[model samples]
Target: MANQKLKRWLKVAGQLIIAVLAIRFVVKEIDLNELKTTLLSANFWWLILALAAFLASKFLSAFRLNFFFRALGLKLNDWFNLKLYLLGMLYNQFLPGGIGGDGYKVYLLNKWYGTPLKQLIGATLLDRVSGVVALGFLACGLAIFGHTATALGAFSFILWLGLIFAFPAYYLLVHLLFKRFKSVSHTTNLQALGVQGLQVISAFLILKSLGVENANIDYLTLFLITSVAATLPISLPGGIGVRELVMVKGAGYLLIDQTSATALATLFFIISLFSALGGLPFLRLSQPKD
Candidate 1:
């Protein structure tokens, strides 16, 4: 028990350090005054739309997870599942060294519904994997359509091929390993696309809020890439630093204005933070009896 606790502590500490260093790197790369100006001048209406899109993405994400749950015979109602999902988000953002939002959900579901733990875990794991696969697919597709292909030359063809095969490969993996989830694979995958698509739209809105009227493809591509980066375990709660660092570097490579890129990342983070707070009210609520 002591060893496990120590390991968790060390992991959190390391993540915190990485998050700080990454933010520092981003701060050094961009002009702070320019970033501040951009942020302060952001259009409130666009920001509100971005927040709505982000919330919609979360709603779709909760619905997608429920599909996996239904596959396991849980059949949780959408409203209840959404509340649980938001609570999980809160735990995920605030409890890095704990059971985590997913683990907590698994524990609760097992206790309440008596589902097989293995299947519950598989459902959760597959839910995350499906999202990641979608993120990769979209990122690769964007790279092909954006300047990344031209920059990569020969390697761009590999990206194109990956984009074509990603879903098929994901389907095969599910059939082989997560047989129980195979039934809903198609539905969940489509939902994953919608979830990510809305997120990209949210990012685009954030850019518009920052007064970026053009070069949207590059910025959106970078947003997707940074999103993947933020998923790395080393990132802090809310993916604080990793996303910013990736945006700064990606902007430099793509010749985007670093200040605007930083502002966009920061705004997206803020919007996500705001959305996650929706789970706060459910935090102390009793587990649903239904």
Candidate 2:
């Protein structure tokens, strides 16, 4: 156990180091002043729209978990899912390891709701898988159709194909888990989440356009794909450079500039903030005992 923890720490440290190197390169090309100006200049309405979109995503996440739990014959409410997910988001942002967010998730539900350990662990895994499929579907769409995907297109397509094929097997997976590890169960409900982003043809374009323009179709798809991928157990702090790395690699497969891909990767973080923040309401509801 100690050795495993050490490895996880070492892996996380490596990711942070890589992220720092990437940020250094991104800093050289990204005009901080221009980026700031673009961010500040975003129409108030657009920000509102973005927040609305974020909330929609959060709600879908919670809703999906509820459906999945019910399918497994576990009784849970949307309110419970919302509160638990929100609390998980906050912990993931602040705490350092697996012992952080969802670890707290298992602790909370097992203690408060008195849910079986297997149900809590299994449900979280299912939630993550659904998120992956949704994200992959979006990325694949972008790679095939978006102009900039010249570099990342094939990567996205491959990922999309994988997710498409895997969707059917999710339920199968849960059954297998039940057979092998009867205590743990996986859920496969995605509720209704949407991915919407615009795009530009090139890095020069992403930098020149109003920063918030629809990500190029491919990039937009990549954003969703990466978003889903970020939820994986193997990830960087808040998925920092990992998102960029995936986008750049996938985008590169299609012809997207590394610099622009990096920039959009940053944008994905900004979007998740709203999604995370939407949980604030649920957080209020989740206040642990005084």
Candidate 3:
């Protein structure tokens, strides 16, 4: 028990340290007053749309996760599943060393449904892999067909080659993971795509909110790339500083202005951070009685 408490304390300390470092790096690397001005002048209506899109994206993600749970013969109701999903999001952002959001869901499902623990783990792993696959696919598509694709010239062709190869690769992966649940593959893939689509729209709205006019695709592409980076698990909550740093350094590739890029990244992070907070209330309550 002492060791467990020590581990929890260590994890919380690590989370705070990483968050502080990330915030400091972002502040040093970007113009604080400029960011403040951008926020002050932001189009609130556009930000509202961005937040809605972000929330919708989470809903779509939760919906996709249901496919995995059902594949394991677990029959959680959709509303209950969403509640579990939100709680998991809370655990993910707040309790990294403990039973994480995913582990929490697995634990609850195992306790309630009496499924094999190994199968629960596999289902969760496949769900995560599916989301990453979707994110990578969209990032590649932006590189190949987004407005900046022309600027990429022959490099676009290389991206296209990668995009073409991605399909078969994804199919092989699904085949391996879904040999028995083959029918769920198509639905899962579409749900994953929808989840990313919502997020891309959210990013675009965030750019618009920050007053980015033309070359919107440039910023959008960078946002997509940042989304990919956030999945790397090497940074603080939601890849805070890491994501802002990615935009500051990578936006130039798409001819985006560093200041606006930083603003967009910051706003999106703020919006997402708020959205994640929605799950906090769920943490205070007991599981809903089915």
Candidate 4:
């Protein structure tokens, strides 16, 4: 127990150090005044729309996870599951050094429903994998259909191939490792697209809010790439610095304005923070009917 606790603290400390270094690098690279101006000049209505879209995406995400839960025979009410999801989000963002949101959910559900821990863990793991798969599919599609392909020159054909086979590949993965979820794989994957699509729309709205009228696809492509980086469990709470670093670096590569890209990343993080806070009120776990 002592060793595990020490390991957790070490992980958290390492994450904090990396986050600080990344933030410092990003700050040194970008024009702080330009970033401030970009943020301060954002359109208020468009930002509101972006927030709404982000929240909607999160709701779709909760629904997608619930589909996996039901497949495991742990039938939870939609409202109950959503509340649980919000609470989990809160735990994940705020308590990264301890048992994460997914860990807590697995413990609570197993305790409450007498479900097998292994099955619950698998369901949770698969839920996350589904989201990653969707992110990959959309990122690949955007790379092919947008300016990224043109920029990649000879390598653009790789994006085409990935877009064509992404889902089939995901299906095969589920068949081999998570056969129980195979029944709902198609539905969950489709819903995953909806979730990611809304998130992309949110990102686009953020760009629009910042008055980025040209090179929209380039900015969005960077946003998607940065998003994948942020999802990794290496950054500070809320992925504060890692997202900015990726956006700054990716913007330089994509020939986008670093200041505007940074502002967009900051705004999206704010929206995500607000959405995560929705779980605050649902933190007290309640026993749901079986």
TM-score of each: 0.96, 0.73, 0.87, 0.95
lDDT of 1 by residue, 53-128 (tens): 9999999999999999999889898999999999998888777632398898998889888998999999988988
Q: Higher-TM-score candidate among 1 and 2?
A: 1
lDDT of 4 by residue, 187-251 (tens): 99999889989999999999999988998888887888788777787877667799999989888
For 44-150, candidate 3 gives per-residue lDDT tens digits of 99999999999999998998888888887887788888888888887776655323788988887787778988888878877877777777777777776565577
Residue 184 of model 4, lDDT score: 93
Q: Assess candidate 3 and give its lDDT.
A: 0.78
lDDT of each: 0.87, 0.57, 0.78, 0.87
Predicted structure 4: lDDT: 0.87
What C-alpha root-mean-square deviation, in Å, does candidate 1 show against the real structure? 1.4
> What is the Cα-based TM-score of model 2?
0.73
| lDDT assessment of candidate 1 | 0.87
Q: Backbone clashes in each candidate structure, one number apiece?
A: 0, 19, 0, 0
TM-score top scorer: 1
In candidate 4, which residue pairs get closer than 3 Å at backbone N, Cα or C atoms, i.e. clash? none
- For candidate 2, the lDDT comes to 0.57
